[model samples]
Target: MLIAHIPGALLGLLIGNIIDRNLAIKSWADLRTRLPVRAQPQLNAEQVLFMLLGHLAKSTGRVSAAHIQSARAEMQRLQLSAAAQKRAIAAFTQGKDCALTDLRSALRSHYAADKAEQLLTAGWRIAYAQGLATAKQRRILQRCADWLNYPAASFSRLEAQLMPTRLRPNSAGNELEAALQLLGVTRSTSLAQVKQAYRRKVSVHHPDKLMGAGAPPAQLRAATEKTRALHQAYALVRKHLQG
Candidate 1:
């Protein structure tokens, strides 16, 4: 009823928000404890490999002997159980060749974009368990970021803050660019200007928009993660400006 008095634009927004909330709640309820018993939760195939790209980065130049072994070792540990582990490995061996999407309505029937994204975030962490995260690892992670429609820089900044030390120093520029790009601002942007830009960017990147885009599972996951990082970036930059 409140929306009835609003302008067309605002009315549409209010209605959309309600629909998204309903869908999210439904997704939460359906997936709460329904993780596949023997399967790796119904995430996209691209999501799995995109994460594998992160793991593979840990041993890029030396992807010879120990790298794959390390991935397997980590995979074994990350897998929930023996059966899941086998399936995970089988999925990994398929590598870049994995299937991405399925029949349209079938996909729509099976997963709302939000649920697909949740599964994608799960996969990214699994890819990181193998220890070493090199530049190559960052690149693969970037692709995962892209799939989730994430601003790669924002997550990298979060990673930098959480880790405190860089695996390499030179990459800071790359990371910053990623964050700034997500904010829809560039380094040339003044401090005060960034805040407005940040708010606007977050408003647009919301998972709700991704859902409206008919985002695939990977994109939904990416957007969700990016939204989080975008918030973090806004805070960090705001603090930097205040100081």
Candidate 2:
């Protein structure tokens, strides 16, 4: 009887141990499921720029051919690789689909001053892609600029400075008009005012100055083009005024 009782006791103890082990394993699995997952990485500045560009492109009811061309031009300017270009296109599409709240959330992270300025500049370029920005486009750009912590005054200045100059059939008049627009002056403006505007534009857009301010290489290249345009504009405008 004692021997029988011993075997039964041992069997019961073994079953209890097995049940405890199974419970322990189940608890661990449940805890794992409840634990927080690591989030995906955030978008970088270039991606964000492209996204904003797409967003601005679609602001005026629908995206136009000019907007597509402008976005392609930006992709070329950035010299994006095939993979990067694909990613940019995807981001642009996402931007077109996303709400303004999503854009605000995406831009919530802080960027360096120069970087912020560069992004804002890109946004302005896209906004003015259709020769002139529509009211909706301007409003969208203003909101984006505010989100980027870019100054409202600076945004207005950029709009004034970067607006595309329209060319007519007259070659000489076209050149003169473009030059004047680039300098932010008019044909009747005094020589002194033109000179002052030229100086101000040069000071703001000089490549060396931008580089010193920690602007990226792309911005420096753009600054170089801008500085050259300013010089040429000043030369033509100066000659026209003096002559």
Residue-level lDDT of model 1, residues 93-187, one tens digit each, is 55434323322232333333454443334434433444444565555545545555555566566455434233335455456666777687777
Q: Give candidate 2's error at residue 54 in angstroms.
A: 1.1
Query: In candidate 2, what residue range of length 10 has the lowest lDDT sum?
Result: 163-172
- lDDT (tens digit, per residue) of candidate 2 on 1-243: 765667877978777679657765356677576679889678876677788888888877788888888888889989999999998988888788777667676676644456667777777788777767788778877787777778888888888777775522345778998899999889999999999999998998899887767989899999999999999899999999899
**Which pairs of residues collide in candidate 1?**
117-221, 148-222, 148-223, 153-178, 153-179
Question: lDDT per prediction?
Answer: 0.56, 0.80
| lDDT comparing candidate 1 with the true structure | 0.56
Highest TM-score: give the candidate number.
Answer: 2
